[model samples]
Target: EAAVTQSPRNKVTVTGGNVTLSCRQTNSHNYMYWYRQDTGHGLRLIHYSYGAGNLQIGDVPDGYKATRTTQEDFFLLLELASPSQTSLYFCASSDGDNQDTQYFGPGTRLLVL
Candidate 1:
């Protein structure tokens, strides 16, 4: 299993801020997933990809943009962030199409004031 990690474990910003959350996988996984967890809601998919330079929109992608720069690098971009977008973000990697065994990283907590 690949080890996934995210940068800036915690962040604080104002409404309309610009933020970028980065995720990297140690092993070369074919698929990567990004999701967010809110106070009372289950994990909601934000974006994902199968490989470098490829992006697949997830369930809650309206306020987020994701990019796969390399096989091991995936980034989530919030150009004009909002208070509603503040949440705990996660990154995961899977070697196969099945999402059942994806490896997750320690989450990135974002706070929008």
Candidate 2:
């Protein structure tokens, strides 16, 4: 199995709060991703990185920012959080050897009240 983990398994914040979700992959994967899961939208990619310091904007790039500091570490930042952004966030990693295979962390549940 893939070794990916996220911090603050659950979070609660008010509107306009600042939130940060952290992830780390121990598989030495070259590619890492951040995604959000909602009721309607099953899962939407928020951002990704091919390597350290390389940021690639995903389909949903607004109100979210991310950074990959090392091969094993990636972080998602929500500077000005909102209620609509409350959802289950996930972090995934891929070795890049296979285009179809990826490993996902459990998930981080966030609530904006």
Candidate 3:
């Protein structure tokens, strides 16, 4: 079974700090995505990639950056972070475009002061 996992399930950060949330998958999926879940906004796309070397800008890519170094690993980078960015961030992956089911990680909760 394909599984996506995230680290530091909980996080606390001060304003103007940098935070990195890690995500890894064992299914060797071809597509990976980063999204943030807010109270009323629901799941909003941040960034995604088709493969390790390719990155595609998503709806809310601002204030966030992402990179995929390998097929099994992908990372989300938050620089000069703000409280507005504080939310539950989830990482998901699919076997391919034909696969509609998105396996999501537990998620990382970021709290900014």
Candidate 4:
């Protein structure tokens, strides 16, 4: 595997809550991304980055924030979490080409109560 790991495999919070999901990739990839998986939604992109301090907004970016502190670290912030935000989030890293061959972290499941 590519050694992409996520913190706090599971999380719970109420509506209008705050949460941070973290991901770290030791593979030295130049591209990192945050995505969410829902039952009927497949996977939706939330945010991404090309390198440290370089952030790119993804398809479904509302109600979320992201920061790339270092090439190995990326974070997803839900300052005012809503029930609709509950989903299985994934962190991935790629070499900036053939994104389909990304290495994915275990995943973080967020539940808004």
- Top lDDT prediction, candidate number: 4
Off by over 4 Å in 4: none
RMSD list, candidates in order: 1.1, 1.0, 0.9, 1.0
lDDT of each: 0.93, 0.94, 0.92, 0.96
Error of 3 at 77 (Å): 0.4
Tens digit of lDDT per residue, candidate 1, span 1-113? Answer: 56899998999999999999999999888899999998688899999999999999999899899999999999999999999988999999998766458999999999999
TM-score of each: 0.95, 0.96, 0.96, 0.96
* Native RMSD of candidate 1 (Å): 1.1
Q: What TM-score would candidate 3 get against the native? A: 0.96
**lDDT string, candidate 3, 1-113, tens digits:** 67999987999999999999999999979999999999889999999988887899999998998999999888999898999999999999997867478999999999999
Backbone clashes in model 2, listed as residue pairs: none
Q: What is the lDDT of residue 79 in candidate 3?
A: 90
Query: What is the alpha-carbon lDDT of model 4 when measured against the actual structure?
Result: 0.96
Query: What lDDT score goes with residue 74 in model 4?
Result: 100
Ranking by lDDT: 4, 2, 1, 3
Which whole-number lDDT from 0 to 100 does residue 45 have in model 1? 95
